[model samples]
Target: MPRTRVHNLNISLDGYAAGEYVTLDAPIGDAGRLFAGFDGRFIHGIDKADAPVTLDRVLTSTWAQGIGAEIMGRRKFGPQTGDWPDDGWRGWWGDEPPFLTPVFVMTHHPRPPIEFANGTSFHFVGGAPREVLGLAQEAAGDLDVRLGGGPSTIRQFLDADLVDVMHLVIKPVTLGRGVSLWEGLSGVEDRFTVETIASPSGLTHQLWNRNVPA
Candidate 1:
């Protein structure tokens, strides 16, 4: 069975995943420091060809590995909200999106699918988490579906108990007010078996695997 996975989801010590206000100039907004130690070049994963062997690189490499399709929130797709403008905004990645697979953007407003030559296509979808996941899984075929998110979207699927695996990088700072990753879903960790690994970069990486019933 193809699994649903989330990787490199950086959250603050205060439980915030991303900033509240995301603009075109500041993609991550005030939460830019959360990814201060991240190397954008290693998003495609590390194979000893580019970056040195490190815990971060090793883990980041798994982001694109075996991921046939991705599901992201509208905010993760762009900074626009309510209704999409006619500015012809493709995404933050321009022509070549880092994701080589089909990406399903969760949105209430629908638009035509955007295709790219680099194998990254954006399909706007409107539905419940499970329904969207089914679409991604269908597109994924024999591979796994990646829940690439902006917290709110991740929370929805998590609330539905549809996520099979998740990788959270916890930073040691507090945003105080922002898009929180855990809200209302108290004790959500009880559903998963967590393994913790602290790195020298002061980031705690938590790998969460959904518990299997006996």
Candidate 2:
């Protein structure tokens, strides 16, 4: 069966997934201070030689594994808002997006699909989490649907109990104020079988799998 999954989501010690003042210049905010320990391959598009074999690298390496389609919030797509001033704003990924499958961008103002040179195609839509998940699942076919997020979007799916598995990387630093991942999610751990692995880079990787009936 196809499942919904969140992979390689980095959160700070203060529970914030991304910092404030998001703009085209700094998508993740704080100049990406939270992702200091992440691999260069993710940030700078560096060669594999520069990336170490740490847990962060190892986990991120499998980011595209079995993922056939992705669903992300509008902010995760780009900094543009209020009617998309220009259709040419492809995305933060440039010409060839890393996601080689169809991507659904959650937004109130839906736009026409943008097809890229690579296999990536961005489709904009606005609906409830469950509704969006259905579209993603249909697009994913037999493969899993990846929930690419920016905290708020992931929280919505978690609240709807639509996520089947999640791999959250807990960075050691704290953002005093920003978008939090666990604000209203009290006792969320009760629904999942939690496992943790500490990496050499001082970050802790946590896997949460939804408990299944025996």
* Candidate number with greatest TM-score: 1
lDDT of 1 by residue, 3-43 (tens): 99999999999999999779998888789878787776776
Cα lDDT over the full model 2: 0.86
- Candidate 1 — which residues are off by over 4 angstroms? none
Provide the clashing-pair count of each candidate structure: 1, 0
Model 2 weakest 10-residue run by lDDT: 43-52
lDDT, each prediction: 0.91, 0.86
In candidate 2 the C-alpha lDDT for residue 13 amounts to 88
Task: Assess the local accuracy of residue 71 in candidate 2 as a C-alpha lDDT between 0 and 100.
Answer: 98
After superposition on all C-alphas, the RMSD of every candidate to the true structure, in Å, is 1.1, 2.4
For model 2, residues 1-214, the per-residue Cα lDDT tens digits are 9889998899988899987777988998773767775664642122356544555777776677788899999999988878888657988988878898999999999779999888899999899999999999999999999999989999999999998999999988877888999989998888999999998878899999999867
TM-score for each of the candidates = 0.97, 0.93
